[model samples]
Target: MFLLSQAQMAKNGKTSPRPRNNVVYQDGCFFIVDFLRFSVPQTTLCSLCPGEEFVRLTITMAATGPAHSTAADSTSASIAPSAVVAKPCHNCRRRRLRCDRSLPSCQKCIKKGEKCLGYGKLLVWNRGVASRGKMMGKSFHVPDQAAASTAASGNQELCLPRKYRFVPSNMPDGEAEAEAEAEASGDEGETSVSINPCLVDPLFQDLDRASRFYISHFTDQMCRDLITYDVPRHNPYRGIVPLIRDHALLLHVIVANSAIHISNVISKGSGLLNGVPGQYPQHDALMAKQKTLQLLNQAMNDIDAVDPEVVLTAILLSINYELVSSGKDDWKVHVEGAQKLIDYFGLSKRSDLSSAMSALRDHVVSDCLIYYILGSTFSARQPNMGSMTSRYPFLDVLPLLERAEANSYMSCPAFLLQIMLSASHLSNLDVITGFEEEQAGYLMERARTFNIDAWAASVQGISSHNDFESRVHVASAHKSAVCLYIHQAVPSANLMDDDNRKRIVEDIIGHLSFILPGNLLLKGTSWPTFIAGAESRDPAQRAWIVARLNDLWEMLPWGYVHTAIEMLKAVWAMEDTAAETTGGWLKKLKGLGNDWIVV
Candidate 1:
């Protein structure tokens, strides 16, 4: 047996004169290749790998028969006895894959669904995960001064980054690759419109085209849709996106949300999931949701060590994913997980978080408060939907509401939320005893006299007449719904008389209808809309509620919207058929067999 490394072949693959020290070949000779590959028979090596290849050991041939093999021996042996240099592409070299030296990109990378970093591109790998100080396993991207000063959290109206100038590559093999990448990364603003498959950050460059689309869609549009009333620059959801992308759990949740939403848009809100308990109607959304759930379940096993913000964000996103599916996508499961996390660890009391995290914290607190209180109001009598948020003294949200009023993305005003929180807290009690009555009465009085116009005017950035009107419409709708919840729910001095309740329900529908479909504030009205729909007694008002909800569905297209609409229809049918049908929203909601967030 003779060992032959292809290194001994000439650059041109022509037969070379035997070196003095080279071993002479013998009968039945076999060749062993030593470039991290197994041995091959001499006949098979020349026949199988027809093209020139680089090997790392000496090659000795059968000199005893016919002196030495030459190019004249066989057509397949043309490259065997000669020396030719072979250069592998960058990806092939790193992965030790055989390369055909394909131009621009390798076939293996294409087949493996990888973005082939072609030859001539320098690569610097992370050295040992950088365990120096707190920077260990952490990286940060600092935004510009304008974004830094705009708000405490989120990627506020970020200035358009400098476009990647398409330099005509002068390198021999990388020119095509440079052009391909530059073309795939369209302008930042066009992500939503164009659905650019390559719109990915350098941090997550390995993601496939579909993942890139979902991530881009979340950053470009979903962030804005989620918040109550913030311009794109000041959107709080943007603040945590960098955090989400790095977290596999969060990224999967975000992508699932975007996927469901995009599906809804594409389907034009058809195929309504009137009621679903098990497998989701949409396949991709369900698979994505299952992945996130699996990751989250693994996370929950060590519940005490998980961050409260992570739990809150996951619950928020999972809720979003459920809302878009129009079925029971297991939102309560996520919330139950969050409740356990809160029960075990408790939210951090320290106020020294980074500005972005602080901003994210406030927004999450506001959203959590809204969802928990709304859930509390609608749920069967219990403080069960959420735990950490309910732990806050109800009255403290008064200051929180006032501060968020001017420039925050809170759907229900802080005062109204404080009232909702207090009302939820009071109503969740075993019974509304005398002491609870005092607190309920105070909240009811405050809600009764809330001047939405004055509150709208107090908002800092409302300069245009249309803007003020939009704010008032949104605030008034939430206020009316909140008031109805308080008067009927909390054992106040004066419970809602049927006449007053009718007026409030009508007020909610009226104010909501005035906001129109194009308004951003309208997106935050789902809870209020549900309350008004569920509370209405008038037939004509119910019909209008149906039509109005259809309009909201057009804009929001959320799973809960259809579910709420169906529930309202059922409630209307129940009211029409039963002789003794008078009941509050919670009494009506009892025995529903599920806990879901209305907001």
Candidate 2:
């Protein structure tokens, strides 16, 4: 009966199983029950003294309730599966903070009883506040000090340069370092038309020192490559072999300066031809081989020992090889050389070497004019479309021309004519080589607009003494037209203006008048021989120049026409002056009869 009563009590949640007859009671998640242990009290009257102790409680089921319960309670309750427990601060979350349920850090956690927990979101807010505080300090306080600290901090992590301390390489020795310095410091403007400040004013670096500096900077291998190879890829030029010749000329200057031993060794291998060793060779074959070596040696020697001005002059003389083509056969060779010269002289990008030639100011104009000659001429004779410039690419001289325009260089009719000739050459080469008809036509049209051929045709009438003045007048008038037309065509683009045009033509006229008689024409030289020589030497160029002169004359004002006629009459009457003059003059004059052949 007692067992049945106990079972009913257990079912009614009144009792739970106890081990070793120990009674248990309930706490929240724990149970505490007490059973009597009989012991004699001090009075020895009580069978069991009143006592309490904790015992294990067995829970059959748990019911939900709020988590903040205090003092153990036994009741029917359950926890919903969806209920969430609040989290603590960030640091606390990572450290699993023990919550004191305070604002930021719990008091217990703050007190080091455990990590105090606040809401993780509140921790983020505190960090933002701290960052703001730091920013305020930075802004209101020592800015330089803060910057220095920042820079110092950055220095610790990065390998940034503090100053320009150049440590040159030891191996493969040469003036490479010097060259680099020159490249860094040298005016990028030096080129064919550039006037060297040193040459003109001497305030610039000494020309001799500068040249030596450059020579030393280039390595032996680099010098050799420039001197020996770098020939035009095209065939006829490859055959004529002007590339090495031009290089040899430059080397001659260096050798003449006694700056390099290498040039002497190479010059010995170049055998003497029909001409004297030092003189300019007349024959093409000799020019390509022997004369090339001679010029190079001379140039080198000049650079080594001569006056810096002389050296500068030598440099110009040697570089002129880039200007002259290998006749009509290997025109591409000259064109390529010019392009390379522009690159070599640091004029490849459209900019002035000096503010000397307004024509050169237009980089696109210059390049378009110059590069096309190479691009076109190299492909001139080729039958295969694949080998031609037109097939593979189109030249863009416009940009260079535009650059010249910016620098006030596109002012000369002669300059414009050069550009036109280049275009025409490209067009003719394309047509001759059977390139696309459309491209050829386009190039032809471009050529006609510049009126280069007309100018060339015009210049033929003027004789040597008056060629200069006559050439200038014709070039000025025609150039004016060109500038006007170009401006009309491209109104927004700054083509050459009237003032610039006049300045350039006047400059050319002044230069020609100064140089032609003193330098080119002498008292006894044959007019026909002179004419023939000039024409044969540079048929294309001479033709073009002559044409420009003719155009200038045609466009001359009425007063100039009468002056030109008087000048012609004077040339015709030279014989009368010779007869009337002294014996010495007569002897000089006698040579004039041999100068011309009526046929």
Candidate 3:
């Protein structure tokens, strides 16, 4: 390799206008300079562009000088033949510092406490000086002393180093000759690097196809359910595609999700519930998943390697992957990992990132809140909602929610989530009897009358489009679910009649029916649907709930959904056996330690 600098090119007048035909541009421009001969007849080519500078090259040379030399006289001319070498150790080269080339190890690396990456064989230009002469429109030949010496000594190893040796494999003679000719006529002294023919074409071609598939299908197809309401003028996943492309970890996660989703569709079409046994291998998907996990683990450990956007993308993709694949709860691990990263970066403490990142930050925080509420509500546990709201001050703050509403796509309604969290806290309190129970009943009554219509109207005022309308439906469903949960917490015989409870369940089911059919709001509806299903005494209504869940499972089959289905069945069975009301069944279900949360 030859190192060229823009300052050197400027000093040598290499940037001056020249004949355009003389300059060759492959991926970029290449300037062919004249050969400068030494005792060794080696040729090297260096390319540089004037407008786009900052190019450095590495060239390997044979050792030729004594070992000991002063720093001032370390140049090629001052060093003895045995001391001067072509390339420095890898560590020194990376640091752009001089190397005192030594066998097995380098002194510079040892002094700096770095591992010395060993030197490899030197790459000699096979065409020699004749190729340079041909480029210059002249006839010249340089005898190959190395080849002649090897032939004379009957030692093939002396002709070329093992690392630089190349042998063609499985190619027709005509094709091999044509390839050789092409290499010869290409840029002079530039080595041709080839990969394994069998591996290169298929692997890279599949990667290209997968990348295109993700770009075209992933955002619209997979993300539509997650983000039901469209932002003002932005595609949520589109803005992050470039970031995913630039990050290996994030890209791997996306590729994994894409491959798994495709595999699932193919499996379903082929009458394979899981996958073909020892046939129709999912190598790409499996490899991508494995690599993503490896890289994600590595990234999590390295502070400098982890970025908030990258972590958030990986979390979302991992969640998507979990939903589509065989039901698994590993997505919770990813969510927890994202929470750790958010805390590490102090993303929840302040909104000081760039506008784009701030939007992402809001979305991430919203997702966290949604999951937290779902977990607490479904499991009959209370989360530290106050702490969460304190960390992310915008969770309950109306002004910040309205300000960010236009930019945050796929985010849960902050006001509704806060109400649900408050209800969950009240549910977890020990207010079953006496003065505390009376006070709690009063508070629950106040919560039930919280003016949801006014809130919905305020949100609708922001945008009256279909997207906002969908959000209004989701908010109403969640508010109904929160009320149901609060009532379930205080199991009073006469607080609400059986007809009144049935009405509440019907209202929630009606609100959810608007968006749940399309699976548009599945991520935020699990808790609501569970509560509604648990409360519904009508066989037809229960069947409808089961059917809707089954449909949702077919769309996004997360492990938690399967668990929720099993728990719902248990609740229904207990109600049948004990002839108990929905509230009594829920109390017994909670006692049985069957708390599974889905979001």
Best by lDDT: 1
Measured on C-alpha atoms, candidate 2 has an lDDT of 0.31
Candidate numbers, best TM-score first, in rank order: 1, 3, 2
Tell me the tens digit of each residue's lDDT in model 1 across 417-513: 7777677666556566777777667777788798877777777343222477778888888888877777656534466777888888878887887
Local distance difference test, candidate 3: 0.56
Tens digits of per-residue lDDT for model 3, 1-599: 23344456576577643423433222223333211223332334343343443222112332453232222112322222234445687777878988887644576776677766646544555543344544433333333576455456643111222122122232357865876686568776544332221112222343443354443345545555455454433445545555654687877777677666656656545343232222222455677788888987887778666676667667767766765664333555665666566666766656667877766666555565455555555554443343353423335334444544443432345555565665555456554556445644664576567665565566566643445556666667766766666666666624566788788899988877887555455555666788889888789999888887777666654446667778889888888887546456556665665344656
- lDDT of model number 1: 0.60
Tens-place lDDT per residue, model 2, 1-599, is 00123444444464653323322212312222221133111111111112222323222211331232112221212211222235444555577645434332344455566543334334334322235543322222223454457565643221112222222222124555655566557675521221221122222123333233323322222222221122223111111112223343443343222222222223334331111222111122233334444553564454445322222223332332221211122223333433433443334353434343222233322433433432232133321222123432323333454333211212233345443333333333312333333444443345345654454344433221234443344344434333332332222233345465345434333333332333212111111121221212234533433443333223221122222233223333553444543222112322333211110
C-alpha TM-score for every candidate: 0.60, 0.23, 0.55
Clashing pairs in 3: 61-86, 64-81, 64-82, 65-80, 65-81, 65-82, 65-83, 65-84, 66-83
lDDT of 1 at 9: 49
Answer with 1 or 3, whichever has the higher lDDT. 1
lDDT (C-alpha, whole model) for all candidates? 0.60, 0.31, 0.56
Off by over 4 Å in 2: 1-319, 322-334, 337-347, 350-599
RMSD of 3: 23.4
